[model samples]
Target: MTAIAVGLVCLLVLGLGLVVHVFGRVFEGDTRPTLTNDIVVGTWRGADDCTFTFNADGTFVARNVPVSLFNPPGTTAPADVARGEWELTAAIEDPGGRLATVQLGFETVGEQGQVGIHFSTRLRSNTVDGEPVLYWFNGDPDLNRRFILEKD
Candidate 1:
C-alpha cells in the first residue's frame, strides 16, 4: 500500500515536471539583440568577400555578394556589386521590440538598358562574442545554416 502511494506521487511529480518544461519553452522571451540606426550605420563583411556598407542616409552598397543571396538556390551568375536602400524594423510583432531586422532593397539594372529589378533581403540582428552581428538563413532556417556578417 505504501509503495503504491509512493509510485503515484512520483508519477504526479513527473507529470508536473513535464508540463513545466514545455510551458517554459513556449513562454520564453526573445533573446536576440535589437538593431537600431546607429548600430547599423556602418560596414559589415561576410564570407566570400561579401561586404555591406550602410550609410546614415539609408543608402547602402553591397559588393562580392554570393549569387545565392540575390537568387535562392543561386543557379545564376553572381552579381559583382549592387547599390540599394535599407530599412530596419522589428522582426516580430512584439510591442516590446525585442528583435529587429534589416531589410535591403536591391536595385539591379537589367541588360540592354532595361528597367532595374528590385528585390529585398532581410537580416536578423544577433550578438556573437559580445559584438553585434547580422545574419540570415542560407537555406531552410530549420537547417540552422546562417550567412553571418560581422562589423568591420
Candidate 2:
C-alpha cells in the first residue's frame, strides 16, 4: 500500500511539472512589440488586399475584405465595407506598454436595416524582416488560415 501511494504521488508531480512547463512556454517567445498610439493609429493592409484604417476616435474602417476569406462555403459571404470600433487595450500611448494588443469588432449592415457584428479579431504586434506586422489565427486548423497584416 505504501509503494502504491508513493508511485501515484510521483506521477502526479510529473504531470503538474509538465503542465507548468507548457504554460510557461505559451508567452515565452512572444516578445511583445512596442505599441504606441501614433504607431498603431494608421492604415494597415493585409496580405489579401484588405485595408484597415484605425482612426483616432476609436473607430475603424475595413475595406476590400472578402467574406470568403473567413466564412466557409455554403454561407452568406457578402463582400462589403464594414464599420467597426477599436481600442488599444494595453498601452494608451506608452511604448513601455508594449505588451498591448488591439481588439477590433466589425459590423455589417444589410440593405433591410439589419445590422450585425460579422467579424471580430484580436491582433498582436510583431516584427518580421525588420518591419512590423499584425497577425491573428482565423480559427482554422490548417495554419495557412492565419491572417497577417503589415503597415500600408
Candidate 3:
C-alpha cells in the first residue's frame, strides 16, 4: 500500500546519503600530507651567497649572490656565483619502524650547485630537532655548513 511504498523511499534516500558521506571522506584522505608536507620550503644561500626563491611550485630562481664571498674570511673567492633549479627527489621513512624523510632531485643552470637546495624543514611529529639540523650532505659538500634556508 502507500505506507509500504513511502517507507522504502525513505530508506533508499538515507542509504544514498550515507554512501556519499563515506565517499567524501575517502577522497580527502589522499590529500593528507604523508607526514612530509610538514617540512617547510624556504630561500637559501650557499658558498656564493646568492639570493634565491625556493618556490612551492618546484621551480627556483636566483639573482644576486657573491661567488667569492662563500669562502672563509681568510680564503679567496671562487670567482663565480652559483645558481640552480631544485625539485623533490625522494621522500623516505626513518627505519625506526616509523614513517619519515623525503629527498629531492636537484639540477642547476650554473656551475657548482648540489642537492642541498631545499630547506626550512620541519617534522610531522615534534619528536625531532628543528634547529642546526644534522643529516646527510647528499652529493653536495665535502665539508658544508648549514645553508640558511630563509623562508619567504
Candidate 4:
C-alpha cells in the first residue's frame, strides 16, 4: 500500500508539470522577431515597387515611392525618389514584447522644388518559412487598406 501511494503521488506531480508546460506555451504570445539594428539595416521593398535602402550609417534612400505615402490621406501624386535619415524607437507594448517605431525624414525634389517630408510608423516583424521578415504599415490598419513594405 505504501508503494502504491508513492507511485500515485509521483504521477500526480508529473501530470501537473505537463499541464504547466502546455499552458506556458499557449500563453507564449506571438513569434514576431525583435527589432534591432542588424535586423533593420537592409533593403525593404513595397508592393508598389518602392524600394527603401537603409545604410549602416543611419541614413536611407527611397526610390519609386509614392508621394502619398508621406502626405496626408487622399493626396494623390506621382512617385518620387528621396534620401533621408531614419531612426527606430520603442513603441507598442505587445504580449510578446515591445515593438519599435520607425521614423523617416527625407526631401523630395519635384517640380515644386525640394520638399521636406517626415513619416513615422511602427516597425513590425514576422517570420516566413523559417526566415525573419520586417515590415511597416502605411495606412489605417483598422480599415484594412494597408500598404505593407517587406524586407528584402
Candidate 5:
C-alpha cells in the first residue's frame, strides 16, 4: 500500500526473522545435557567424618552420622551409625539432561528397632577440580550441613 506502511512491515518482518533465528540456534545446539548413574553408585566420605557406602543392592551404610539429626541441640548421643536402603527415587534435570536435583529415599533403623524413612535430602552430581563428587544434604535443620563425598 503506502511507502511508509511497506517500510514498517519490512522492518517488523526482519525483526521477527532475527528473533526466530536466535531461538532456533538455541534449540538446535545440544538442548539436552547428559546424565549418568555411573559414579553415583559408590562409597563417599562426608566432611563431617561420616562414611556413606551406596551398594548396588539398593542398600547403604552410614557411619558416624551426626547426632543432631535426632537429638536436641547440645545433646550428644552415642555412636551414630545407620544402616539403610537408598533408591534413586527421582531426578530432576534441565532441558539438557543435566541434573538439577536428585531425590534419594533413605530408610534407617533406630536402636529401638524403629525404621525411619527420610525423603528430605537432595543430591547433586557434580565435579570439583576434576574430582567426581556426590553432594547431598545432611544433619538436622538447625545444623544445615551439606556433605560432599568423593568416590573411594
Candidate 6:
C-alpha cells in the first residue's frame, strides 16, 4: 500500500533505535550494583559454589558449592552442588528498576535437581552476619575487584 507504510516506518525507527541503544548502555553507569537486604549469613564468589543465609523475619538460604570447570584429562572431577531456599524480593521490576536484592529459590545440591529455583542473581556490597563475611561483586568491567568481604 505505500510500500507497506514505508516498511512499517522503517521498523518503527529501527525498534526505537534499539531501545535507545540498550537504554544508553545500562544507564551510562554510576550506580548499577545491587543486592543487600540486611547481611544474612553469607558467602559467594566463584571457582565453585557459594553460600548465603538469612534470618530475622525475612528468611533466606543459598548454596552453590560445586566445581566443574574442565575435565577429560583423566576424568576425575565434577561435583555440582547447588542448594537453595530464598525469599527476599524487596521490590524488583527489571529493565533495571527497583531492584533491591531478589532471590527466589527451591533448588537442590545434588546432581540434576529441580523443583523450582528461578535464577535472578545480582549482588554486591560485601555483607556480614556471623563475622564470617562474604563479598559479591561481578561488575566485570572493573577488574580492579576490591568490593570484598572476608571470613567464610
lDDT of each: 0.79, 0.70, 0.41, 0.67, 0.59, 0.45
**Model 5 — TM-score against the truth?**
0.53
List residue ranges in candidate 4 displaced over 4 A.
1-29, 71-74, 95-99, 109-113, 143-145
Model 3 lDDT at residue 147? 38
Give candidates' CA RMSD values in order.
3.9, 6.9, 14.7, 5.7, 6.6, 15.4
Best by lDDT: 1
Model 6 agreement with the true structure over 1-152: per-residue lDDT tens digits: 99999999999999999999999987664342344455444444444444445555454454443222211245254434444455444333344454344353435434456434344343323224423233444334267443333424
> Could you give candidate 4's per-residue lDDT for residues 1-152 as a string of tens digits?
99999999999999999999999996674566556778788998876687888898988777776654656676577456677777766556554445445667665544343765555434456666666555555566566454556777
For 1-152, candidate 2 gives per-residue lDDT tens digits of: 99999999999999999999998997575555766778778899986567778898988777766564446456566445677788766634444555467887777634332567566665767777877776666666366465777887
Point out the higher-scoring one by lDDT: 4 or 5.
4
- Against the correct fold, how does model 1 do in TM-score? 0.75
Local lDDT at 83 for model 4: 75
Model 5 lDDT tens row, 14-97: 999999999999767532223345555677787668677777776677677554333435647533656666555334535444
User: Which residue pairs collide, candidate 4?
Assistant: none
Error of 3 at 127 (Å): 10
TM-score, candidate 3, is 0.30
Error of 3 at 58 (Å): 1.9
**lDDT per residue as tens, model 1, 35-78:** 78989998999998988899999988777777667665544765
lDDT of 6: 0.45
